[model samples]
Target: MAKILKSTDLECFQQQGYVRIPEAFSPVDALAMQDFIWDKLEEKCSILRSEPNTWDKHVTGLNKSAENTIYSDIASQRMCRAIDDLLGEGTWEIPKKWGSFLVSFPQKLNHNWTVPTNHCNGIPWHWDG
Candidate 1:
């Protein structure tokens, strides 16, 4: 099979510690993921996707649904191939399901955004750790 990630993608990963693979999954799959997340948000956090005013938090986690197939839907073979390209075939085991994904919601309030000069300054912007 043809490589899903190119040489430049590998180089970028080497230099920047990450890479982007476009269309790794279909739009339908993405929508499904979004719907699942929104449902979780409403169920756990009382945040409704239909109401923009309720988007209070920048990050909300959905951790409990680890065995759902929605994860597998988003984890397309293209994405797996990209991973294999980077890490080598059979080097890593892809989880059947994912636990604890954070959805970064856009704040309804407006504010000036700037790049953080230091680690401590970047507290507002963080990963799903």
Candidate 2:
């Protein structure tokens, strides 16, 4: 969380249809995630973190780990404010924990199978209210 979201940022998101918030997450906290990922990789396979050459095959699935140890300090208050501005005040709901994670592999799978597509056409869009 840094500066407040100005009208310019909202305008850019409306015109360009996207906004990039650099360094939203803490780099120092995120750096530790490398070790957590490596530890999980080692549990499934014999590939060591030091030996990158051994990590040739890509994993199709992964074991679920506690969000506390895996994704610490990932929430960005700056991002939340920006989203709130776009969606309306108090519209964005901060969850108690991480949810709805769908990690697509580098290899191609199904074409249509994915998260809900929002082309902003006649799609059924509404709030939980």
Candidate 3:
């Protein structure tokens, strides 16, 4: 059964350009997904889960072409329902209609880096739709 959205969900999406569903995915499920992504990354990029030093970029999952909708076979039901409720029934499609799986692995291990504070407040060109 699809989970119905509260009025606040709609309001938040309208105001913030995004809606966050709490407790939609369990921590165990999330870890499983991360494991799945890691497997794919290792398969495609040869980056082993034990070796974090090999993980150069943030991306770990496949780019997922628009022509293929096979990923639906693996998508979580909760996610599909949430997207459908938020966007509309049958609105959730593959990369062509919806979007790709952007699995980003955060690099948190101790490293010499500094957050850049000086910046011109503007949309990054990559996101300048």
User: Taking the tens digit of each residue's C-alpha lDDT, what string does model 2 give over 62-115?
Assistant: 535545545535456765666666777677686556532232324445665655
Better candidate number, 2 or 3, judged by lDDT: 3
- Highest-scoring model, lDDT: 1
Pick by lDDT: 1 or 2, better one: 1
Model 3 misplaced regions, further than 4 Å: 1-3, 22-32, 58-61, 65-70, 73-77, 89-99, 105-129
Across residues 7-105, which tens digit of lDDT does each residue of candidate 3 receive?
A: 888887777677776655677766665676677778787778898777765663375542344344345566667777887878758343434457555
**Model 2, poorest ten-residue lDDT window?**
99-108
Q: How accurate is candidate 3 locally (lDDT)?
A: 0.63
Score candidate 1 by lDDT: 0.77
Indicate whether candidate 1 or candidate 3 has the larger lDDT: 1
Candidate 1, 1-129: lDDT as tens digits? 678888898998887778988998999998888888888888888889889788886554466775777888756798888889988988998876656566776656478877565577555544422
TM match of model 2 to true structure: 0.52
Query: How many collisions per candidate?
Result: 0, 0, 0
lDDT of each: 0.77, 0.59, 0.63
